[model samples]
Target: MHISAREREIINLLLDHPDGINVQEIAESLNVSSRTVQRELKGVESIASAHSLFLKKVLGVGMYIEGTPEQKNELQIAILKSGQEFTQKERQELILCSLLKEPESIKLSSLANDLHVTVATVSNDLNKVEEWLKDFDLNLIRKKGYGIALLGSERKKRKALGHLIAQQLNEYEFLSVVEDEYESKTRFSNGLLEIIKLEKLTMIGKMIRDIEQQLPYSLADSAFMTFTIHLSLAIERIIQGEVIQIDQEVLEELSISKEFIIASQIVIELEEVFQVNIPIAEKGYITMHLLGARQRQEKNDWQKESSTEMVVGSKKLINYVSKELEINFEEDQALFEGLITHIEPAIYRIQKKLDANNPLAGQIQEDYPAMFKIIQEGLSEAFPKIVFPTEEIAYLVLHFGSSQVIYDNSKEVRALVLCSSGIGSSKMLASRIKKEIKEITEIEVSSLANLRNIQIDQYDIILSTVEMPGFSKKYITVNPLLPKKEAEQIRDEIKRNSLTTEATLLRKLHNKKFKKQIKLKTPKLIKQNLEVIQQYTETVLHILNTFETISLPFIPTSSILLLEVCKQANVRGLIGDYFEVTNQLTEREKKGGLGIPGTSIALYHCRSEYVMQPVFLSFLLHEPMVVKAMDHSSIKINTLLLLLAPVDMQTGQLEVLSTISSTIIDDEESTRIFTSNNYTDIYSKLSYALYDNLQKRFKD
Candidate 1:
């Protein structure tokens, strides 16, 4: 009962065309097999009979509903009374039966493969088909390895076919209309041969005789013959439940019809039947044949227009022309505008020249050498040109080039800044003004005392900390001594000059920041950052350890001593020295009036490794130390110690200091381990935690 989407599509296509579709055609349309179409139809038959619907088959034409006209009428009335309640698949199957003139038996294997199902399923469908036809003394006749056929009395078959036809007419009125149109068109044609090809040879002879009587002069011309062949092929495909693609243009041209209404109608019908929209142009020239109004081919004449008249000026016009010619153009504003203005008139003039009757007009190289050169240059610059009428050329040029002219409506002003001395103060003021007030019209800063020496007409607003003589009162004045509030006031004035300028700039800035943030978060960017940091640190470490001994800065008198402790044991020489300095610094720093004791200081040489790798160390003070000089009371003596090492170090003693800093600054457990003298244990614990944190944060 539940049909797949593919089965539904196939059923719809079949239902679209009445009079019976061939099994092979159905297979082809559904991209399966004739056998598959048969099996699916059988399944449909079962479902229908289960619901008291009749399915019947014709001897040669195809299958239909088996019932008398009155019975068919009754079925139709019942279906209407029931409001046509059916699933999409059921509806599709009904439609197919209505469209098809004949339904044929096909092999179960072929059907199974086409439907992508097991042969057992096909057998089950056959059983249902037999059950559906039981009331009419009809049943599915299976031949070994051949296929299954409907076996029933001719009267029963006719009645069933009538029932199907009536039902189809009720559901889709368009099917009858389409068939009528097709019959009208092919009534006198020999194309019926194509439709009868799949039938038995004995039937073909009878069909030929019937065709001859009906269409005596249909084969008189090759066009009619071709139409017959194609139409018959199409009918055969439809009967077989296959979707067919007929060349719309070819059909129209072959028929010698100027209008393609018939072809369009066919497309619409097919679309409705199959529920698939085919990609095709709505309008196009059919080149298969030349007939009537289409017989006259326009000649491409070059000497009909003036050169200048052909020029295109406007970007919009250029774009229109380019689109017509399927060409690409640059989308930049300035370049496009310039191209439109400068080239439009020239093209128009050229068009005019080309349109002249004189033969010389077409010879651009001889008659208008300069114009020809310009065209060549434009072509090289990727501009497109088409051989169109002079008027069209002129229009295109004007359209593409009209936007090039720049309009100036705002007043222009140049202002100068005056200060006592043109040094730090004046420079600072200029920088501040530039940064804050972007719209000052024009700006000039100078300490030159004589304002009358320069052109006074250019000056608008004079800003000076000192007094200036001979200044016009009409000009605005502001102090040169820059203050945040004064800068803000000037900014406000600039904002008033242009309402949207600041907002636009801010939007642009925000957009840029957003783009940068996106780039920063990319995996590639993070990897690159890590690589650069590692490289820089390694290089600095190499330099500091291998070369350069440097003296430390003299400790200032105001320096707060941090540590003072007796050296307990002899450590590694450099390490011992570092410890002594750190201990003393920690004691001295704690001695200040501020109450805190756990603080410690660490020192290292300046080197790449030390600088690149941050230093973190942790230790708990034995007794609480106080530094009264400091202010905050939240500071506690029992705390973690951290030290930042320089990029260059004289002694290699700072190596361990690097890892210590990295640890204590990040996780809490590092401080615990450092206080416990369990460096290795602390490293293990922190490393595991770090790995877990990174995995959780960075998993894809």
Candidate 2:
């Protein structure tokens, strides 16, 4: 009988470890809970017995496979070829995954018949699948008479394929790390699971830990996952005797590098575990990846050994980059200082055939196309002798990108509004600040009389209507009414003070979080870290299910858009019209426009007394409607979602509600709100995934 992928891995691990390995050791290496290792132990023995072996376990000593080397190798070979069969959900995911990962286009009818579903159902499923494609800057295009194919960048395609494989082995962070309430996880594959196997993934995970120990830094989670997948693929090829060959010169160069040394160390462990001979040139492969993986800067320690040559390089790079982009960075001292610190270590790694690895290079290219393209072309000219890896190049792009932003608004900006004249003026000023500034998260108004009692240190900026000439603090003086010109003046003043910018704030926050300048509120600096929290929660409030979506005649104006969704939700008994949800949504629109920047989707959400329970309401226009965005740019909005929750709910509870809706409308999530031709498919794909993710996140 073919064993499950996970059980196969446990068996292989036991076989490799003749001296025996403990449950905890196995769990740590695999990045799984010890409880999972224990559960799999029961099945390992039964499978081992079939091959004339015993998976013997001692209470304190650990577990081992008792058999001759010949029997062990025979069992290992059988397990290598064996793999778990796909479930119905997995088959559907596999169909979609193959279309994206494979080079050739696939027929819709073929996929439907293979998955034992009708063509119509498969067609509907493609809608939800297409949503995932959008996130990678890819399009899942279907030719009328031909077949469907995923079109995008090669790197993005690989990343998507990596994610698909990760999902299959139940290695997904949401499914594995989180204690989700769901009975089963939906999985995907690209016809490689039987070849790659879960055992390889566990070994890959161990390999990553080993590499990390030798480095001065750590890779981002996405970067780490990408590396894990790369290593797994390498091992799979090794098993098939498809070893990679590196040029003699390149191999010699990489052999002396620290990254290659680490890679060599990893190979020793891998060779022992898998009992396969890894090619000598495989070290170069790992070395190249080490250079390609993105690095998150943990400190300014590079500043300590500040070398003059590095400073010169940073200056030349900054100058050429500024000229190429037609921007001013000559006088940005901190930018100079940061670049110098970045370059010293970067060059040290690059010279040794390794460069900093950045997993979000694709995102940087997508979001800042011009910047990335310009930097890519001009970097060689900027630093004549340097051969920068793609990851290092992207890192440089980030430095220049941050330098050009209007101002740094990274922290939760707090503004104390003071009016010497009256309380009303201060309140009015605070309201105008809220309307004008998206960056300022908190506003506190106080009269000059009570200003002494209010802690000035707590505030990032002090905005006063009446200037106190003798005031010892830096404050921006604004008109009481806070007109557009006056608001612009305040913004310019804030920009002039570069320390108050988002870049500066983020750097400070990152240091604090990393060094534990503040207490650790999380199990690790992941999921709950500032970057991660925002990353996951950015598209939280969106449409949830097909029932939540209502088709509308082409919306003409913002006023009508608000009325229709509230009315639709109210009619369905999902909400009641105190028009409080409507009023808040309209208020949001008036602040700017209803349209989300950079997309045709408009999101309107609020917590209101009018809300009975949490409800997600979506409206899609029959034809696109032009609406205003925050920047006053006209956006053709095709989709809109209204998320309403009870006013008294906790922020975490609100996040759960947002995440549920997001699973539907979010372009990244599996369950889509707008794509399915038949609405009922949304209920099945969404109802469980949405609830399950929420439960898992909450438990963690």
Candidate 3:
């Protein structure tokens, strides 16, 4: 019997506690949620059955193992002697690897036997595998007795194959294979490795490296590795007599391009090395890959691109998003450049029907649904003829999201950001690290290909978006978007390292001269610290004082209600002109919904030159008004939370205003207080929230 690592750990816990243990106790012990423990229990039950034992549950008592001591000991011994087995997810991937590589129908029983699982288990795995294939536009064909086959165009089949390999191996592992390490094969099992022989991978890698200098621009590490694997797989398929075809018209058009010439050269070399007759159509596909490949360019090199349409499209996108959000990004040059770099290849990928997979798509969508929708709308308006997938849209969101704010801090430590391609994710990750971590003074981004050439001692720390295999130096692997949990983790790690460095320095300076130097600067440091604290306190007070709840008379329409709020702000000197601010707010509303979902409140927020400072005001309506919710659904709202900030504001002030936005939808209690339209309750909530933030900023 095969059991996962988590299942073994769970069984061990149950064995230790022969007595009943509640689900909560199990969850606490494992450092997992109750839901995670509950989900694992279903798998745990199967292990118990295999060991001739049963789990006993009693009302209000919890669960315990019911079996003889001998049976328990035998099961424990088996677990101790057992090696790591294939997880259900790994098994499913192996199944996909087999199906994508196989050109003929494969039997269900054959798959079951190879995986050391039952036919029923394989069938269940196939159900999930089918859904995964659908993302590549491939279909799984299963018959009762005739067996199963995967049906798709050769182009899609190859796309699916490449994605599977990319998904299975991290950058480090992928590079290891290309370097002829073959270490990945030890863990990946036979099916995936059988797709391309190790020797072929090494040869392809060497050939690509030899020809790297011939190209007009250098390929990013991700693009280089992807192209290498693609060529290796194409050679393998060609050897097996699986020929692919390309459109003649497209081929004829591509033949005159520079990429086509390079593609032809690559095919000639491959034909010589593999001793196979390469077809003209193969060169056409290679040209497409080359056309869509991401090339490493300087940060300001976006203007160098030959495509004028791409530059115009990028400007239109930025203008659309700027108008909709009521923020000025027309002059954000970094944003314009990043969009040019991302959108150019994005358009080619879409035109070629390529799968631009984004692992962070779900997280990005969940975290910023409003921004996601806005970007989606902007894409439609900017590139009307092209239909971008969610994956590509998510990547574009990262580019815009990163450019939304700017952070300036007095950082002392230098860090390097190593991403797959130094493009969308790298820019976002670097921005987030600098924004959140004050100690990080400077950030430099590099592709994985440049890792070897980087001066390690120049950087105090190394941060990577992908895993680095065979790397001896210390590096923290972080997600591109920098989720909250990972941000905290990065903070803790930086702190720990800082303490170590400081301790060493203190030891080295354990003398009278060092002590005298520190004492000399004590008064100056104290005065500087006092000023910072006073500024923080003043900012906090200003934000809290500006926060107010006003009860407005009945307004029959949304537009009139907005004007009333703007007029109130103008009368209170919050804004210089109510008409201009109202116009800005109206434009924002037309772009997307501002209503908070699952509540009777709407949040109208904007950054405008008309606003004097950051303001958080609540307006209670005598009658509920119908508005659009964040999810694009109609909602009835009785409260309006107007959050405003100056067009040019300090990062600290922006943070406080952003905090208010978070607090409105933070949880049930805070949302309830805002929705209740109670002045004292809301004031207390903001006070507590700001207090917590102030503590972090002034923790020194």
All candidates' lDDT scores?
A: 0.38, 0.62, 0.75
Looking at model 2, residue 194 earns an lDDT score of 49
lDDT of 3 by residue, 304-414 (tens): 754888888899999987766545678788888888888888788789875665545776776556567778999999999999898789988778766633111112466
Ranking by TM-score: 3, 2, 1
lDDT of 2 by residue, 459-568 (tens): 66788755454465556666544557667766765555443242233334345455663565665555444444443343233334225556888667767778877888
Top TM-score prediction, candidate number: 3
- Minimum summed lDDT over a 10-residue window in model 1 is located at 287-296
lDDT of 3 at 98: 84
User: Looking at model 2, which ten-residue stretch has the lowest summed lDDT?
Assistant: 179-188
Please give the RMSD of candidate 1 to the true structure: 31.4
What candidate 2 gets wrong by more than 4 Å, as runs, is 1-112, 115-199, 214-223, 291-311, 320-359, 362-381, 384-394, 400-700
Residue by residue across 1-700, what tens digits does model 1's lDDT show?
Answer: 4544444444445444456655545565556655666668866565446445456565324555553445434433333333233433333333223223235666667655644557786566556545545644666677886576666543344333333222222212312233332221211112122233423222322332343333312221222222222333333444455442335654444454433444444445545644555333322211121111111112122213213333332444445433432233435355454443334333433432211111122332332232233234444343346343332233223333232221111123344665432322233345446645665656665544335565543343455533333333222234333445656656554434331121222233344557668656788877865664454445334423332111122222223223221121112112234444554345433422222112232221112221333333333444433323222233334332333343343222232332233343233444445445344565465455444533543463
Residue 635 in candidate 1, Cα distance off native in Å: 5.9
